[model samples]
Target: MKRYALQPLVIGALNPESPVSKHRQLRAILRTHAQETCKPGDRLPPERELAEYFDVARKTLRQAIDSLVEDQVLKRVVGVGTFVAHPKVDLQAKLTSYTEEMHRRGMVPAARVLRFDSVPAVGNLAREMGLAEGTPVVRFRRLLLADGTPMSLDDNFIPEHLVPGFLDDEAPMSLYQRLDERYGLILQWAEDEIEAAAATVENADLLKVEIGFPLLRVTRHAYVDDNLIDFSVSVYRSDRYKLFVPIQRHGMRPPRYTKITQT
Candidate 1:
């Protein structure tokens, strides 16, 4: 019977005489509580205690909590009760490396290289990288993580000439940084096509999500002096990351990048 600090804010706030619906009011109150008072993983008061305090039925209380859960502000565990949810990282359309972006978000980023090898470029990949068919390409698959939690599964393809001697042991955490320092290849810009898809069994297994879970699929084509140099496809856990376009992409402060200092 530990008391939740948020319960004080909720007391006497469900004005039944107010024109607003009680459930809606309660939902707003809870949202405010979450933003102003609660941190991620903070346990909410039991449903029965909250319902009794609000003088509303359990159904109304549940309705309010349900909306917050759908919005990703709250999470429910069976037999465990509700808790504040960890914030989702927005996939901002900024031209920064994943390591740099994760640093900006105050999360540690790492890559677990699942597969790495040189292969012949096929029809679409050859055309995409502006290379002749059957050209040697270096392809690597990696499980990308933030704070040790799997966030994305990636397949990065590059013309072998672009990254000579690139091996699994020397795979870079910040590809952009490696390209700059090791190969002296300055990345110009990249274009991405994003879509939603269901996770495959392999993707589910690697990302630690249930099979058929929703994922954000991003295909990127990177350039150097207008020459396409790299093509990569990344599948991100939708529950952990959501994509967004900023009102202004340019003139923003550049990220403090994380270098390829780890194995």
Candidate 2:
């Protein structure tokens, strides 16, 4: 039999005489356990073992697992076993804080500030920054790092009127954090688009990846109170990063499949 540090909470709440089905109660408890403790890709006990431990029929146990699998909270592999699914991305549009996203993945984060200067914005950059065609703006370039490894390169332009002391201070790991903490720039909302492209020769040299490797490019425009505050272009390494965007469809359920086996 497979062993686990199975918590008592998983089976402690069942009432043999309750109105609820024992299978239902067991399913609820197991779902809670996975949410609170299990890492993505962690495997659960086999169906037979769970059925025996919960004192439920095999059919009942299977039904409970199936429901959770549909919820995207759990997944089963045919030849292996069920596991917690890694996060998935949604095609629907949304905004995200890069700092919070990286920290959640258990990576040590850092950023290298390459250039910080107030210069005359030109062409479309001035328009994006909500300035005159050649208005002065702060241009910044940074290399975002995870676990001391280069993961992405970011370039941003902000109107000088919005961030007064931005160029004076040394940069931090997260520009968003610094904006709110230092300049009192409250970021109300942002719009962004993501796409895939091959790393250019310059990008490959800076990111330490092979030239022409696939990369994820994200372009963003951030705002505060109907005012355009920042515009940025970021490029990320494809091999080192996997994006997870959760989604729910309107009709039929999504398919579930497993990819790993346990010894």
Candidate 3:
């Protein structure tokens, strides 16, 4: 409910003679002002006031603000003015559950089990799980949330025989934990492929983002002792999440030989 007053120094005329377009100039100035003066959750001045201060038309001002909103540098509520956005989460490529990762970031993780049922595996599902066609597989469609905000939509397929009673109502937040505790199936490793994607209507509704919004799709195959346990596809909000991978150089040395006199 707190409001932030725009800084007076940001009120200046745009350079018309400059090569940059008026909207682009306005956007750059606003971006700098927001970065320098605005704190996260600080509401920006009203659109009319910003237009007047920048000496630009409302439409031009709107275009500039829209760019920031798309970049997640600013957030606009219907009635409330725009506010600076919080930092995006950096997700590491690790074999940890979503709940564990969120908890490590000091965020409360929650999951809504949208769909949980057993279905016959075919095509890629069968091949990925190394199961015969028509094998019964438990499918989980879940929406993952962090601090009550939608973060990702997960669709997972697991061999049903490996996880008996998993579709029951009393399901744990962390499926890996459940598999380890109840089925003694340890997840030793996983391979993940990450790519950019657009949010589909169904996923956008669950994630609370606009349809066709930018998203990050992650396809994963988890294993236990070289046996596939589950294959999952997760779509994350690109504006809210960033994938991080750490690389290290492997130390190697060519063969070194000493002359016979060195003995």
Candidate 4:
């Protein structure tokens, strides 16, 4: 009654006599197609059409799609069809700036400074930076982007006494680069904490994600020896970014401060 066809949706023919199951065979075909022929956000054909073209039951086709979806090779919307998922970036947990990390991946990095102001350090902000309650601090918010895609919203705070006239300084792409090259504030040690979170309304708007989307919350405390220099909290899109941390046993020397390269 109904007919369906695909020119290049799936490559070659499914091996009916092969040892692999039908769904797995279908998955391999789909995977190959997605990798070779399709781009991220490219939607696959309808389930019925795919099932018919592959000459398999709808259940088998659905199973194959589901497997890919779980692997993040594909993503499905409620009313929308399944689409190829965007590639995720793996950022190493080293003393590296966002600009350096993106450059290592052959990506272009940019930042849009939303607000920069001198605020009185109060409450936890004062205690965190080891500054007096009424001390003035530089607070700036930025939207970090990689290849024109929104990646994170970063909020950084620094004691104004340490960086006097910072607002008048030329805006740089990387804060770490600026601190290292200009101020001789090479950070010797730092701490980073990551947690799972949901996108808030404000965050979602900046990050270009739906409300309540999954996010990775990262907080950092960085210092030059005993002097706290920078404290930051960044919210990242989980679907597009991942943290890569290396683990080692004791007796290994602690990681040292890496020199920031000027770009």
Candidate 5:
């Protein structure tokens, strides 16, 4: 098999007299070169060549690369060379399924059902789903993928009565789509709360990241016609995903002005 190499556009040499450090200058130069010349998933040149070309020590070159990796501008495989990173997915605050969101971004979406079974609702599950204790509920654990890369681990719970035969093998990739098409239960609205978390050992393996990496935990409650229908806890890789919320000032009372009395 032919191996492809990453070729950054040639740029001016770094200025030693400048205030900026050499490593920082190298990082900036490489970032611009990568953005201009390399596509996502393009493999970078060997470390030795890159270091020699920049006339910097290997340690300094590695530092620059590490910074880019942390910023998600580049990705480093253990044995493989570094590569350009795909743009992070911006998740808007909206009622949409993972499949729909990925499709809108022109990326292929897939799901692997890690666990699907009927479990009795208890504790917070019962309270959140508004179901009696011991009521049957469909539990779905799925690994959501985009463009063949794992994006999130979703644990979803829904009232079993609302979705019959949900444990079958032929489950759809999009739970919302299945609900609407099979059970006529369309999601009307949802509320989500996002917080930063550390990836656990199990989640790290599933998400292909190192343990304790930063992650975004999103807790969601979906409703249909004012009835709580589904609840889910999804953990997303913070490096590959971001949440976008639009904020605007509304309903603020204008400054009260008193009419000035004529003298």
Candidate 6:
């Protein structure tokens, strides 16, 4: 008996006369099936097994798998067979920085400066960064790497007035650490909204995921007191990150009926 259960493969049949290549269609099918059934840390069938099962040429199957890997749907191991990547999570309870989180797990954290440019703020983006409309704001976009492998894209917007001379300061490895040490800026709290999305062309290339692959988009505003300090949008490889929220019960139940307020 096979130890690993054979999941029901759901590859739809190719159009007999469509212009689209069968290899491309196979890639879509496999990607969809993996999204529906596989989570981070799941192992996929070997290339030979997948090719035999699909009755396609090895080249065809390899092409499909390669597409999936690029989209970040699947990841390949060096010597071992490819396994699903587990989504990373924050082990610390207090709101923490990505650099600190990765360091806690013994992973090397590095950032590649993709672009750093200053532009006039406008509309809600300006409001979120606490800049007057048309006021200059600095935008920093980086590809975050863990242990030399790409995992996420961080795009941060900051009001030019808040961090003076920020452009000259080669952003340290850890933004939070720098905020505390250099400028005496203390990061107190942040508000975050998380949603799922497909990797677009830009995100696909930056994250090394296939186009249209699933990802987690987190939009956040970090604040110091009543002033908004930074607005960041982070897109993470869904296969490489798992968001965890712990729930607790206080054993308090709502009253069966509300008591009238006394004057």
Highest-scoring model, TM-score: 4
RMSD of 6: 13.5
RMSD of 4: 4.0
Q: How accurate locally is residue 3 in candidate 1, as Cα lDDT from 0 to 100?
A: 58
Kindly state the number of residue pairs that clash in model 4: 0
Output the TM-score of candidate 1. 0.77
TM-score of 4: 0.89
Error of 2 at 215 (Å): 1.0
lDDT of 2 at 160: 84
C-alpha positional error of residue 57 in candidate 1 after TM-score superposition, expressed in Å:
1.6
Candidate 6's residue-wise lDDT over 1-263, tens digit each?
A: 13224653444556757798878988888777677778666788777776666668899988988887876677788788776545344433235677887787787888999878888899988776666789988788889988777788988887888888888978667777776787777878778787898999999998888999998788888878877777899888876665665454578664342111100
TM-score, every prediction: 0.77, 0.57, 0.70, 0.89, 0.73, 0.63
TM-score of model 6 (CA atoms) = 0.63
Q: List the lowest-lDDT window of 10 residues for candidate 6.
A: 254-263
Pick by lDDT: which candidate is best?
Answer: 4
lDDT, candidate 1, residue 135?
A: 96
TM-score of 3: 0.70
Regions of model 3 farther than 4 Å from truth: 1-42, 46-82, 252-263
- Kindly give the stretch of ten consecutive residues in candidate 5 with the minimal lDDT sum: 254-263
Candidate 4: stretches off by over 4 Å = 1-8, 243-246, 251-263
Residue-level lDDT tens digits of model 1 in 1-263: 23545446353377767999998999999998887788877999899988877778999999999999998889898999999987887546546788887898788999998878899998988877888889999887899998888988989898898778876457787877887888888778888888898999999999998999998888889888787777899888887876544344478875543221111
**Residue 145 error, candidate 6, Å:** 0.8
Each prediction's whole-model lDDT (CA): 0.81, 0.73, 0.80, 0.83, 0.81, 0.74
The whole-model C-alpha lDDT of candidate 3 against the native structure comes to 0.80
In candidate 2, what are the lDDT values of residues 1-263, reduced to their tens digit?
22434543243456788899877887798888788778877898788877776767889888888888887778787899999865442222233455665676676667788888888988877766667777888888988776677878999888887777777777666777778887888788787777888989989999988899998887889888898888898887775554555454778675342111111
Candidate 1 vs 2: which has more TM-score: 1
